[model samples]
Target: MVAVRDYKTALEYVQTFEEKDGLSAEQLMDSSVRGGLTYNDFLILPGKIEYPSSTVTLTTKLTRNITLNAPLVSSPMDTVTESEMAIHMALLGGIGIIHHNCSPEDQAEMVKKVKTYENGFINSPFVIGPNTTVAEARGLKEELGFSGYPVTETGDLSGKLLGLITSRDIQFVEDDTLLVSQLMSKNPVTAKHGITLLEGNEILKETKKGKLLIVDDEGKLISMLSRADLMKNQNYPLASKSATTKQLLCGAAIGTIEADKYRLQLLVEAGLDVVVIDSSQGNSIYQLDMIKHIKENYPKLEIIAGNVVTREQAASLIAAGADALRIGMGSGSICITQEVMACGRPQGTAVYQVSKFANEFGVPTMADGGVQNIGHIVKAIALGASTVMMGGMLAGTTEAPGEYFFRDGQRLKMYRGMGSIDAMKKTDKKANASTSRYFSESDKVLVAQGVSGSVVDKGSIKKFLPYLYNGLQHSCQDIGVISTAILRQEVDNGNVRFEFRTASAQLEGGINNLHSYEKRLHD
Candidate 1:
């Protein structure tokens, strides 16, 4: 025979308890019995969940001027980011920083590719000459991964469109010597170039064609719209785009040397939106000078500076007009800088300290390395990182540079740190990314701070990124935070709580005493 308490009585009783379950961010980060802390050293306490996980907002700032729908950034590693990776990342609501491990012309071309990328429109569609053989068109289909090509007299965009060719037109043709002009469809449906995307969609639906060519008054093709692109647009509604051009945002890394100034001019001409002053140690006079120079010369380009891990380093870059700070040193999966140099801070402490300071200036901070999973990304944001930069995490994806190789019956791809000896030796001093970052291009002997390795194939980023986004959204829901901005605000006000985990507590939090297990992150 027990009596249940009324709702008012239960509420009052719960309110009377003054002690909380966990520590505040100030209490957790300020208490330094140990030297430094990492993401595994703590956990965030769960709060009341009143909304659905699908409703959580993951939007955050990439720099002082750039806001993204997602807080994920691909690192500026040669194997991690190129034009392909940059285009897809911007489409998925994050941004990629193109690496400068190639010639200036090549890097600028990559930047141009990203700048010209449109979601539903294929600008500069591939064209073929009317005399092109069936065998050559098949070879092109295999190489370009697409089947349709517009036939032109000059085999380029400058020529007038004569006809169109598709896979279905030649699938059953037995003669390999047949010319495209013999099998092409003449007078394909088309619209004027000035038509809106909605009108283009209507024309495509009404005509029931796989592609709709937009042409000028002279009948020269301006662009092509594909049904596949339309599907992609519907799938990714939160795509990150420029407010003016509606083009995908693009960023590229540049060295701090005087020669880089000329390289940067070419990139600026290619429509680079942001420039990351790539450096291993960003507090040097060289980096500060470069920051100020870029600020004075390229006044409109947003700058993200540093591979810094301390408040002092962050302050110098921010004062020199860095719109954003890249935190973490020697914390990458492939990096051995902490072991060889012994001068870097632990990632969790570094992010918390620098982000806490940068927030005062309204400057955002990017936690640059050592993030292995969604939980690590959540912890980084909880500690105050505005975004997380990943290299290895994104290296093996389909969009990343490099072809897949098989070993031991498992698919793998190359993954390396910028400090690796292999990376430094891959290129000469003219355009080498690793040697320039290490400031040892002139040194007779090169020391390695990172290793070259391979990661298991992570498949296409199209499937992978949505998985990460959904996982992050659910994590935020479990924490009772609907948005990253509010989460940080609650942390500052001492409402969101944290708890330092002991070594045994960390072990207990994971699977224990398991003989065998299979972990599947996504389908």
Candidate 2:
């Protein structure tokens, strides 16, 4: 037996030695006590930095083949993303998935509009026959918000370019039944089909013409150039576009029903870049069969599968040839899946686990929900997420689908989940009973996995997204990483560390004991 003094000396040695080690990402997550971990539960440790935040790069892949200058994606919810939102997202270096709650024809047209918005030339400009009435032209102008129509002998694009019609020609017309030919500008300025955009702009400026039709030698319309487009000179350096056609990249969502297959054909014909198999639970036989069918039929079209939270679910989708995995289940601000079904993991844990597993197979993963702030975005990227998909974060902006209203002196926009009762009711009455947006259609009574709500106005994506992009760069600078790829690598190698925040520490971190405060995102 050792002496009592020797035991005391050993105890003293243990007490004197201290451990200052930080927790790895995995350690911080796996050490969660009883409850699941969330983005707010922990904080990333600051690292050594030698460069400015402006030098940081945020480029990351949105899919196995598609890269985004910013690792951001707008959600496919109807109230969140549509043609306008999708176009703006692409312009800002992210992508948006057009929601499929509308008719297939309407959805396809939306996709077409995005692809047609920015092009070297408008290959298919809106055309009206010489017989089109002034009433019809006015209706077109009212509906499409443009009055410049190319008047062809026949209504078809391949017909002879008779002349051009502009607001100037129709503004003074009092007769509603008068044909467009009577009011059209005869012998309008024309450019040869092979003329470059610069040359076409020069002709427009010289002739003071609002519309410049590019025609073949036979005088058939080949393309058209707009004076407005030239004057705007909008340059989206990071716009997502196809390498071959240079059309803006667009995606559409589809369910696992038989009708969706027909819808997919229409979307693909409209130059859809990707298809998301939209479902709350993605491991169903319906989803698996649909994924296989799409991969077999449209091999080039990338498929983003699932709202899965577990590694096993991700593995199944990955084996089914999913190009990217959407991680998060009922983690949205409007989602109540966890509360109702008693299922679904926290968003942070789900993102980390699914992304880590998907990365092994060369498949990227997106954090689908629960992105309340910029810090949450940085945390998701550090956890190996290639892109973060936002619904609520982007919902209240100017580009969002719904109109803003004053609610108790606050300007707000309507934002409802795809699974909410309001969305289902507005979608289709008959289909609401059959379709399952949130996996609750099998129940006798429809139980909503999400709620209808409103978010405060956040101005426009033009200002908000840049703020997010800049804030993310600052976060990367703080982590001592210059790019999302490097950040993920450091996280994988246990170089990027984290620490769990206790209740007291969390209180200390926030603005506690304050009577009031004003929060402004950016100057």
Candidate 3:
């Protein structure tokens, strides 16, 4: 007997009455791509899928002798990536990039925090005194790049809080001698340290402030709470952006001989997967010697050297004991090196040219900066990045630094360029100022490229990563491939098709009445 049914009834019969027991789940996979996928894949966010799982190893191979579970890497943008976030990412199976925009000490502290996270014992924060002058507060914010301080009644947390200070309170205050009480918001709202994050958040909402100073039952400051902390706790705004525990390859920058020694020891103890010989120019003898030193000492360590734009510069570093090369000049949103210093390469040509040569040696390369979205990530991977290094794109998410702000019915995170003036003051080795020392150096406060704060809170990478993965998988599925490696092979084999046309062609296909969730349309 032959049976027939309409679309709705057929779907029901397949889901309910169809005989699925004896058949292997694999057989039905292709039959139900729609049902197997989440809404994210269905929407088809843009990205590339270079190879299929059945063909290539998704488990990325590191330079010297390391391996990673995930192919993902976090950007080193100051606003988006930091030590805490880096440690969390490593714990979860990815690497965290430390931005170069900050001072070596502050950046080192960020790295130290990542290291401290491993021991599980942490140095909690303490508040500066209320008597701390506005001039001092300004200096502190400038030096640390964060303003989560409250004024202590007795000059520190042992006493009560007479006022609250934030980056905003002293941002424009001209009276350097003015009492912090005059500058800081008075008797600001706070939360008891013992209170749950939920309870504290409720109190914070009622007060409408950027942070809630956590105190003991006796009202002594214990810790500070910002919207970033709250969201991370709740795994907001995206579960993918949540902090994870992945033992990851982490790299740091060191200029001086002493800094390099300490950095080297830290890398070894941390079981670092890769060490980047960070420099403004990759061809410098300093980097060459440093790379050689690291390889000779930690002969087992993998080294990625250079910020090179050409194969000529890249070759020298590669010959000087570099395992992989970092290619980019100044294509970063916050970087003005190409513009200011007039030395660098256009990112596309740089990747294409350097990757071409590096691939011959079987030594992989990483594309640093110049990535904005999933598509860019795909392109970089296709162009020869074992993995992509992002900076600004990863910033502003929950996993990134800073507190989230709610204003004008929208949520946003603080984002800045590494080369920006504010970042320079906080991380420059020359700053030689403590969080307490440079409480007022505004001339260096050049507020460069990102003053408009052009960043949105995409929740966290915990959620965002899944979105990217599923989206990429769907891209492969649609293109008739099974995994990322296969996609790359196909392109290499000339089986993957490429077409270039005017942008209008994008609208030429697809259903006009495809209807979005929020709106219904009819033909």
| Candidate topping TM-score | 2
| Residue-level lDDT tens digits of model 1 in 146-198 | 89998887899888899999999999999989999999999888888888777
Q: Model 2 reaches what TM-score against the true structure?
A: 0.86
**Residue 97 CA error for candidate 3 (Å)?**
2.4
User: Candidate 1: which stretches are off by over 4 Å?
Assistant: 1-8, 17-20, 31-35, 112-118, 126-195, 213-224, 269-271, 403-411
Q: How would you encode candidate 2's per-residue C-alpha lDDT over 413-487 as one tens digit per residue?
A: 999888787877775443531155565545667777788999999999988988999999999999889888999
In candidate 1, position 438 carries an lDDT of: 80
User: Using alpha carbons, what is the TM-score of model 1?
Assistant: 0.85
- Rank the candidate models, highest lDDT first: 1, 2, 3
lDDT of candidate 1 at residue 233, scale 0 to 100? 64
> Which ranges in model 2 have alpha carbons more than 4 Å from their true place?
1-21, 31-35, 130-140, 168-212, 230-235, 430-435
Per-residue lDDT of model 3, residues 460-507, tens digit only: 666666555555455556555665565555545545544322235445
Q: Best by lDDT, which number?
A: 1
